[model samples]
Target: MTVEEVVSMVSLIEELEAREAAARVRVEELESQIAELMARLEAERETWSRLRVTRETVAEVVAEMSVPDTAGEPGPEEPAEPAPVRVVGAVMVPHWREGLLVDALPDVYRDIVEVVADASTPMQAKQIVPRIGLPAVTAKIEGTPGKLKRLVERGWLTEDQPGLFALAHRATVESGEGAER
Candidate 1:
């Protein structure tokens, strides 16, 4: 064959090889899809059978509902007192203070934890902020600088660097109070 014809044939061979590779990939994808569809079909069949059984039971119950009541109006033969409601076991512990704390902070802070406990080097509050909560990070970082400085003095937080305050661990702050437990 001529060089041009040979080159053209080589290019066609390469294109055919690429197409065959693509077809193989498509076949694998189709086989996986078939497996998933078969699984779904089996589950659907089981659910349909369950629904049919439920419908049959409901039909029997509906037939029972149509039966005439044995008792008409009872002429003052019934007892006067109604039954008392019953609750079982260690039913509830009403921690009102914890409820107030939870209400004070929007729920998002539940996820947020400012890790100030036992690290060789202190961490920045900004990095710790994302670790703490979703509601708003402002609980650890908010308000005017003067007020914030006062909060820092009050030991609510410890500034690791400028514009960065690591939340003082609750245990450290609560240690002085009898509520420390």
Candidate 2:
């Protein structure tokens, strides 16, 4: 090749190398910005999660405090007779003589009860896991079937067939009526 042609090619190579280095620096800056934004997003998400938990805890405390003590009288700090609380979209239900059955239930049993209450037909324990959104891995655990049978024994559910279970049709167990439980 001629000297002039070789000189032109060397200049072109130098320009291309400079552009490549600049592109790498820009990419690093963008990556740092992305990492900072991701960290901020995670912090905001954790704050939101904590707020949700605090709200739920406050609601439970208020509900429990609204109920009168077992002595058939208001607490000394409370008014002699507090005004009746009428919850919006809530139906008046007769107080259960046996107390809240759901209060005595474990989380899994309550989920089972809710699933059966919503179902049009009775469900077997095997059928219940997926309907209640339990993980597939949990369905394979031993004693899962026994848990459903125990619900029947506790009078929360009834066995319609050999293996199928349904919610007990009691006043305190019906939908809307016992929803507070």
Lowest summed lDDT window (length 10), candidate 1:
90-99
Q: Across residues 25-133, which tens digit of lDDT does each residue of candidate 1 receive?
A: 9999999999999999889867876775566445435533543343565348543322222223211111112112222221232122124333335445445444444
Instruction: TM-score each candidate.
Output: 0.35, 0.42
Misplaced by over 4 Å in model 2 are 68-181
Q: What lDDT tens digits, residue by residue, belong to model 2 across residues 10-62?
A: 99999999999999999999999999999998898678767755664464455
Q: What is the lDDT, from 0 to 100, of the residue 144 in candidate 1?
A: 26
Identify the leading candidate in terms of TM-score. Answer: 2
Model 2 TM-score, 2 decimals: 0.42
lDDT of each: 0.46, 0.65
